[model samples]
Target: MTTAPTPVPSSAAADRDSTRVGGGAGGSRTAPKNPLADRTAPRRRLRPAGGPWLATLPLLVFFAIAFGLPAIAIAIGAFTLSPDAPSGAGSFTTSNMTASVQGAYSTALLGSIKLSALTALIGVLVGLPLAQAVVTSRFRMMREAVLSASGVLANFGGVPLAFAFVATLGNAGELTKQFKLTSHGWSLYTFNGLTIVYLYFLIPLMILTITPALEGLRVQWREAASNNGATNWQYWRHVALPILLPSLLGGYVMLFGSAFAAYATAAAMVGASIPLIPLHIADALSGNVLVGQGNVALALSLDMIVVAAIVMAVYLPLQRRSARWLS
Candidate 1:
C-alpha cells in the first residue's frame, strides 16, 4: 500500500514539537522573569564634590578661633608667668600646677565633684520618670507644654536663677518668713540649697535630653515582650533599662558637667563661702584673694579641662551607643 508519502513536518512544526517536549507540563512558551525575584544591585552613595573637609570648613575655623586659641592660651598661661610678672620672674614654672591641688584648691575641687555628682544623680532619678511620662502621654498639648516649659527652665540659670531661688527660699525671704523654713534649718546658700538649685535646671535638661531616647523605644519591642508573657516591670528590667542605660548615663554626665562648670549662679549666691572650682578660678583670675595669681587661675582652668576631657571620653561612647539603637 502506497501510503501517502509520510507527511514531512515543516521546520517550524518540528521546532514547536521539540519545545513542547523540553518545557514539560508547564507549557511550551518560556515564562516571564519576575522583577521581585531578581536580585537588585546596591545603590552607591554620592559623595560631595569638595569632600567632607570643605563642608566642615566653617565649623573648623570657628572652633579654631573660639576654642582652640583659648585652649592654647590657657595651656601656655598655665605653665608661664603672666605679662604682669616682676622683672626677675621666670618665664615658666611648675608652682602654679603644684599649687592648684593644694589646701583650699583641693577642697574646692572636691566640693565641685560632690555637687556635680549629687545634682546629676538626683536629676537622673527625677527626670527619668518625668520624661517617660511625657513621652507615653497621648496628650499632644501636654507634651508641647511640658517640653516648652522645660526648654525655658533649662536655660534659666545664672544670676537670675539665683535671684529667683533667693526670693522664694532664701533666708528672710517670703517662704522663709511665711513658713519659718529657716527655723527648720533650711538655708538657700548652703550645699543642699545649691543642690536644689542645680536640680531646678538640671532636671529640665535631663528631661529634654532623655525624652528623645524614650521616644525611640519601639512599640514592637513592647508588643513582643507582651506576646512572650513579660510583665511591665520585667520588660523594663530586661529590655528597656538595658537599651536606655547608655542614654541615662549620658544624661547624667551632661548634668554633671553643667553643674561642674556653673559659675554665675554660685558666684552670685554663695560668693567665697562655698568652695567650688569655678569660684576659685574666678577668685584667682580676678585677684580677689591674691594679686598675680593669673597663672594659678590658668592652672585651675587646665585642671577643669582635664576633668571635662575625662567626662567627654565617657560620654562620647555612650552617646554613640545610644544613637545606634535610637537612630
Candidate 2:
C-alpha cells in the first residue's frame, strides 16, 4: 500500500455507470439527472382524488339558485318594511319580525308544535312494533311486501293521498255508508281525523327508520341473553331498548319535522278551518287582503328555521348516543 488507497467511486457513480451500460455507446448519455424530475416526481405529488363533490355539483348549484337565493331574499324582506318597496329609503327594520313573533304567528306556531309532537308519539307507538315484527318474522315474502308497501305509503303524501282519504272517509265518503251498520261513524275533516291521516304516513316513516336499527341487532346477542336466562321483556328492556333508543328518538324527530311542516295534507283535509301554521303561512302568501303577503316567504323561511333548529336540537344528542352505541 505505497500509494494512498484510491478513492472508491460513490453509489451515485455506480448508478451512472449502470445507466451508461444499459444504454448503447452511441446513445445519448443518460440525460444529466433530470433536475425537475425529483421535484415533479409522480410518487411525491398528491393526486386529486375525485368523489361526491364532483358528482353532486349539479345538485349543489340547483339548491343554491333555487333555495339559497330565495331564502336570502326572503330574510332581507322580513327585516324591511314596505313589502313592495324595491329600492329607495327602506332599510333594515325589526318591526316586521316583532309583529311576526308576537302576533297570530305565535298561536299557529304553538299549534304546529303540539300537532307535530302528538304525531311523532303516535308514529313511534305504531312503528316500533311493526318494525320488530318485520325483522323477526319467518315469512320472508310477506315481510318484503309489508316493507315495500310501507315505503310506498311513506312517499304518498300531499294531494293524491288527501283525495283518497277524502273519497274513502270524508263527510259523504263510501266508508261512511259501509259503517252505517255501526253507530260510530268517522269524519275526515276534524283534527283527530287529520291526525289519523298523518299517522298513516307517520307509521310508515317510523317503520322505515326503525327497521335498519332492528336488523342491526345480532341474533348471537339475543341467543346469549337467552342463554343467560334473560326473559324477552328483560332482554329487550336491558339490551335492545338501549341499543334502539337513539335511533327511535332520531326517527321521532324526523316524523315531527314532517308533520310540523305539512301544508298540503292539512289544507286538503280541513282547508282554512283547522288553521295549521303551514296553512296560515300559505294563506298569508295567497290572500289578497293581507298587506304583507309578499313577506310570507320570510315568515315561511323563519318557520322552517325554527323547525330545523328544534329537529337539530333533538337529533344531535341522539346522534351522539347512536355513535357511542355503534362504537
Candidate 3:
C-alpha cells in the first residue's frame, strides 16, 4: 500500500498537460513540416528571378552594329539607282548583275573560283606534311621557329606581301634580276601566279589550323595501335584520318573564303588588268560615275553574301560533327 503513495505527475507532465502536446497515443492534432519542403524553401528564396538577359545585351549590340548595319547599308546601296541612270528612284533591279555576268566579270569570277580551289587543294597537300613534320619533330627549337614563321606568314597579307612578291618575282623584281629572269617569262600577275601567291598565305593558314588537329591525336592511342601490330599508315588511315576530316574540311572552307575575298593583293598585283569581283566593287564605289555603280556594288555585296552563306552551310555542319567526336 505504501508502494508509491500515489505517483505524482512531475512539472514536465504538468507542462505537457498545459500545452496539450505529445507523441504518445491520443495526443492532440498537430501538423509536421515536410523535411524536403523545408530544405527547398531557402533555395527558392535565394534564386534570382531575372539576370541572364543583362549578360547577353553586349553581344546583341555588337552584332547589330558590326554586322546588321553594314548589311542593311549594302543592301540599300545595291538597289538604289545610279546617278548616271537616275530615272528610276529607289527601285530594285538585276540589270547590273546580269551585265556583269556576261563579260570580264564572269571570266574573273570563274578564274577566282578555280584559283581558290587550286590554292586550297595545294595548300592542304603541302601544309599537311609540313604540319605533321613540325608537330612530330624532335627538334623543339626548329619546330617552334617553323610554327612562329608560319604564324607570321599567315597574317602577311594585303599590300606588303603583294609588294614582296613583286619585288622577288615581278618583271623587274630583285630575284628576277639576280637570276636574270625576264618579267614576261615569270609573271606573278597571271592567274597561276596569283594562285601561287595565294598559296603562300593559304599554306601557312593550313598549317596553323591543321597542326592542332593532328596534335590532338593522343599518343596513347598511337601507342595502342602500334602495340597491336598496326603500321603507321594504318594507324593514320584507320584512326587519325576519320577524326581529322572535319577539321580539314573546315579549314579548306576558311582558305577558300580568304582567297575569294582577297582584294588588296590582287589589286596591287594585277590592278585593272584583272577583273576580280572585289576590284570591280572597289572601282564602282570610287569611280566618277555614281548612279548605276551603286547597283553594281549591291550585286557584288549579294555575291559576297552568297559566298558567305555557302561557306557557312559547309562549315557549320563540319564543326558540329567535329564537336561531337571531340566530346
Q: Would you list the C-alpha lDDT of every candidate in the order shown?
A: 0.90, 0.80, 0.81
Cα lDDT tens digits for candidate 3, 61-128: 99999999988877776656665674775666667667556676677667667777889888888999
TM-score of each candidate structure, all chains considered together:
0.83, 0.78, 0.79
* Top-down TM-score ranking: 1, 3, 2
Pick out the ten consecutive residues of candidate 2 with the lowest summed lDDT.
81-90
Q: Relative to the unseen true structure, what is the C-alpha lDDT of residue 88 in candidate 2, on a scale of 0 to 100?
A: 38
How many Å off is the CA of 16 in candidate 3? 19
Indicate whether candidate 1 or candidate 2 has the larger lDDT: 1
Q: What is the C-alpha RMSD of each candidate to the true structure, in Å?
A: 8.4, 7.5, 6.3
By TM-score, is 2 or 3 better?
3
Stretches of candidate 3 off by over 4 Å are 1-54, 288-291
Task: Report, for all candidates in order, the number of backbone clashes.
Answer: 0, 0, 4
Which prediction has more favorable lDDT, 1 or 3?
1
Question: Per-residue CA lDDT of candidate 1, range 1-327, in tens?
Answer: 777778899999886666553464775674455665453422223455678789899999999999999999999889987666775464888878989999899999999999999999999999999999999999999999999999999999999999998999998689889999988888989899998998999999999999989999999999999999999999999999988999999898899999999999999999888899999999898899989998999999999899989988987887788788888
Model 2, runs deviating above 4 Å: 1-46, 49-67, 85-89, 181-185
Better of 1 and 3 by TM-score: 1
